[model samples]
Target: MSDPFDLLVIGGGINGAGIARDAAGRGLRVLLCERGDLAEHTSSASTKLIHGGLRYLEQYEFRLVREALAERERLMRLAPHIVWPLRFVLPYDAGLRPAWMLRLGLFLYDHLTRLKTLPGSTSLRLDRDAAGAPLQKRLTRGFAYSDCWVEDSRLVVLNALDAAERGAQIRTRTTVESARRDEGAWTVTLYDSDKRRRESVRARVVVNAAGPWVGETLLRTLSVEARPKVRLVKGSHIVVRRLYEGDQAYILQQPDRRIVFAIPYERDFTLIGTTDVAHEGGPGPVVISAQETRYLCACINRSFERQIGPDDVVWSFSGLRPLYDDDAAANASAVTRDYVLELDTDGPPVLSVFGGKITTYRRLAEHALDRLGPHLPGLKPAWTGTAPLPGGDMDGADFERFLARLVAERPFLPAATARRLARAYGTRLEHLLGDARALSDLGETFGGDLSAREVDYLVRHEWARTPDDILWRRSKLGLRSGRADVARLGRALANPSADPGAQRP
Candidate 1:
């Protein structure tokens, strides 16, 4: 309700939500505004890993890798529900890099940081190991390593939720139209895209965590003098029918020395991605091009015997990586995923972030807050490293045991629904599925495993204002639901007040 906040973060992506949560926890009065849903632009489109980029060893980015590796464990401990450890099966190919080099990389990735909850990397013979069963029999050897799989969009929402819990205001569908220094504070005009309403906010500092839209948010929206140059790299993904038998994810090494992942997703499908190409246009409207579709399908077809064609592709999406324009002259994959903070301090400070991975958002937030230290007189020390994210209070963040106990407690919920709720809500699964005796009590099924009750919770609690926000971002139902289900959800969310819990102030 205040015109001026102590801090105003521009984007609602992972970086923005992280900064907002950090700053708010440090006792800064904060306000976060997103033009669309949280992670609508880029954050959710990530490969959804929270591991040290083993490939970055070639770039000699030891610092970034170590920090990312450490953060991966920390985040898994913080949000055990949305973030969990996953084993990546790096299938070996004779055409790709040698086994010794891959081993060296895995060795470094394992020893880069102090060990914690996750296990170390190991070698596997494809002929004997279960992880290799689905792969083309030509693959004889592989390396199994640990990484984290996160509900990328939920990471943003949980951070935003934690920020709000720490007394920050999160405004979705709100865009920062203009920001100007007035006296010693920032006068920011935020426009609501849905209501066509305008409001003003003031902040001693502002953060432009606008991901792919970072440059545009500074130049077009805020009219700031300082602009951090960012290179937009387009990456795309395709969802296909489950190709493998187990929950293990595949990391395919391509001839171009690039890596692609085939991760088990949404129970019945596998998620394969992504091709890196330079993109110089709008980020919001980015889509999977025909070439990208072919590229992904070809990569899978080459690796698997089943031959996943375009017809088997059920869903596809694209995102632009707003990389900090480092001096690398090659393609998007070579561009550093490391983030850079550009502070525009002509009057009221503006900290703009560029090019960060979902793996390192927490540390990125601490670093961003550190940059704002001179502006905020009495800011507290960083505390996110130890604090558990909202529902991640499980014993030592071991989600498997927690899920087992949850299912034991409520045998009524189907195994699939229980696992989904437990994964989505952690210890708070009790709250979401409270007193529901049967599937009917979970409310109307919206196709897939999505239910009306979960939709209501997201709308009332997580600020999901649109159907796609619920279907795609908040939940992965988009991969499972049909077009008719989406259309129905659209009509329902368009007038969400009709839902039992959709009313929000």
Candidate 2:
């Protein structure tokens, strides 16, 4: 490109990727830069639910709830492969909120979404229903509700991929060292994280979708006068062996009126989590504290007959929520889950986003683009709702049905391996596998549905620049694969010239 034509986005999280995808689709030449792997920050570290947070109703946030509800359905329609319907069993506790109050909240949640394929919320009898099988024989009444689950990191990648396919430049391992606005455009110098090299670009408008780093990106890098305050609330999750026997997930009530989720994850593991506490430090490399692990373990042990100690915890991860600093005196859990867009329109326009979720990213992008309308008068009207994300073009967002078609054609492949491929790549599985015949044709197996061919495909198409990018983010094969297997893939990838796909120019 001659220069950064129209816009330069500073973050590769969901908000930044979504904004870049939207702007590029609207005929603006754009560039998106990420300091690390995409979604390595707060965007990937989410509760992974695409719902109109039922608890937000307690704060009287009807507008945010309604908008998120609408986006939930919209995302389900667009990316059914990665985003699917999940039922959460909320066991009732008489001491906490009364059954009637819980019923009222459930009633609003049911009606908030324009009920389509997702089932409405219903009251359940813990003794009578299968959802209550894993719980202790305490408390009789409960509520089972529906929400959507998403692959958070993949969502960011898909947006970035879509943006790239539309002629937008996407640079991973690239950090914005400094940005300044000249007469009508932004002058930005970026340092590559891997190569330790610097490159520069100039654009008419700049977007700071840096999530938790939004404040620092403005204050330290851009040297802006006013920085939008954002609260960094830490939330953590622990992966334990699957506790329940069924597909349903449990939403447990804590002593402090907070909630925890124990959902089925990657076949054999149960992903449980999320304690909201005030965090003062930076967002990078935030790990689950020992206290957080204990809090989560205690929360799980309180409700279920199957007690899970620290030993039961196989893996743990934590993320910081860059929430908009709404003046709330209560705890971090009580802080608002809403997002805000701060625009600097004085000289060259700069739009900074604070506090958003994976559920509402599309709408957030559309709204962000709308805020920039005054600057880019020739921008196209907002249209992400009607467009399908990359690899989500399958009919009706139906993965199973699409998998059946893939299997029919590739009958030689194992059913489990094929299903895994179908879920991860959707209709693109055929393109990834590409006329391969037997198990041996897939090259070497790295255990748990991972193969050499799949690794090659990811490095070629999905931006797998690192081992963690392949093992954890692109897929959860690392949870099952052994150390030796990971080392094998690492050694193979290190010899870039020997690899079939080594970032060909």
Candidate 3:
């Protein structure tokens, strides 16, 4: 029987985290509950781009593209550590999209947003350029455009961290068992998995940003029945050993009219992906199928000089997108990438978020608040666009300069480790490193430069409870960690009291 909250956000994915952060900053008493770890689902499984969705233009989704493009610049400023500019090369083919069509699309992508900061698109002579080294010899002409890369899971956690700092309660591994409107408010029953206990609380408004589970949450959790407005589309990705020798990514157009991306990944690997297949099952555990693996390999083999097969895939993941059912396009790839917010006023106000991508999450939050403003009084104006996310307060949003400064300050750190820490924690590295002058001061290492000091920091501040939380989401060092490393880390987390000398900052 805690004090009633002003807002209860049920989901820890990007949208829910963003809404919680925005609402809390606006002075609302907010509570965010997630059934699993934050971003354990769709948010972390994204293609990890903060782009305008260049393909969405073909579907006539101009507003979505424009808003996303604008948000790209804002995110780069707000989280320069995790979001940065990336160049993508789209190679030309004799039979696929005409060169004129490619140029037109690039032109529109370049001009859609007035706040463009990245370099504009340009036609490339792939045969003579370094970008052409790995591509097929026939792919001579192409176009290069600008987008941005994001540490998707970290982005979600940072939003939740900001929300907590602003006085919002973020409860991970907590599930909303049921919610019912009672006397102009919502009585929510939450089940904390770790504690195996249930508690009841009240909320003035409920925001269902449950991502793929929006429909399930409505029917099973909230006892609301209505025609489903969400279309479940599953997208998957694969990671492999390094494929090329450049920082730029490639956008290969398939004969089926869909495009796939091959981007430089973790220093030693390449990331490829994203197949859109209509998901018929419930939103549960999903993995890349054999068909999908082959399809992706075939797509890559069609354009690249370095051919690969399913055997080359080192890792793969899949996630479901609960798209707003426009009910016009039957094909999953043709479905709109836009979002829809449905507000139900029959009882106490409840807002259900239908479809949204990682790029436009901030705007979605702003719009969610705007939609709820009439019911909730004394809310502050939108301010997230100008605010820096946690650890994103570097001067001028210049990550390189910040990295150089960090290296100069801590010359003891290895160059690679310094860059990784700089990119992951930004200005917060000062706090993490705290009074320490050497690597030994950071405590025991668990491979991949992961230290006990950093582990304690995550446990104390980031709501990290397990090895997977530290390995996969908070950082992607899991790719470099081995079984022994994971086991060691798990033991350390289970018995934190054993590390008597572990630094706590």
Which candidate ranks first by lDDT, i.e. highest? 3
- Distance from true position, residue 315, model 2, in Å? 0.5
By TM-score, how accurate is candidate 3? 0.98
Residue-level lDDT tens digits of model 1 in 1-505: 4656889898999999999999999999998988888888788888877779888998898999999998987887889898887888998899789999999999999998895678888999998998878889999898999898898888888889889888988888888888788899888888988778997778889898888888888887767756458999998999888897888998888888788889998888899987898997776668888888988888887777778788888888888899999776577788988889998888888889998889899999999999999999999999999998877999978898998998888887779878888888888666677788777888888787788778778877788877788888888877667889988887877774754333222
| Per-residue lDDT of model 3, residues 1-505, tens digit only | 7778999999999999999999999999999999998999899889999999999989889999999999999999999999999999999998999999889999999998899889999999999999999999999999899999999999998999899989999998899999999999999999999789999999999999999999999888888877769899989999999999989999999999999999999999999989999999998879999999999999999999999999999889899999999789979999888999999898988899999999999999999999999988999999999999999999999999999998998998999999999999999888789988999999999998999889888887888889999999999899999999999999998894743222123
| Candidate 3 lDDT score relative to the true structure | 0.92
* Model 3 per-residue lDDT at 454: 91
| Residue 347 CA displacement from its true place in model 3, Å | 1.3
Candidate 3 off by > 4 Å: 496-505
lDDT of 2 by residue, 3-46 (tens): 55688899998999999999999999998889988898787788
Arranged by TM-score, best first: 3, 2, 1
lDDT of 1 at 270: 92
User: Which residue pairs show backbone clashes in model 3?
Assistant: none
How does each model score on lDDT? 0.85, 0.85, 0.92
Model 1 CA lDDT for position 62: 94
lDDT of model 2 at position 287: 90
Worst 10 residues of 1 by lDDT: 496-505
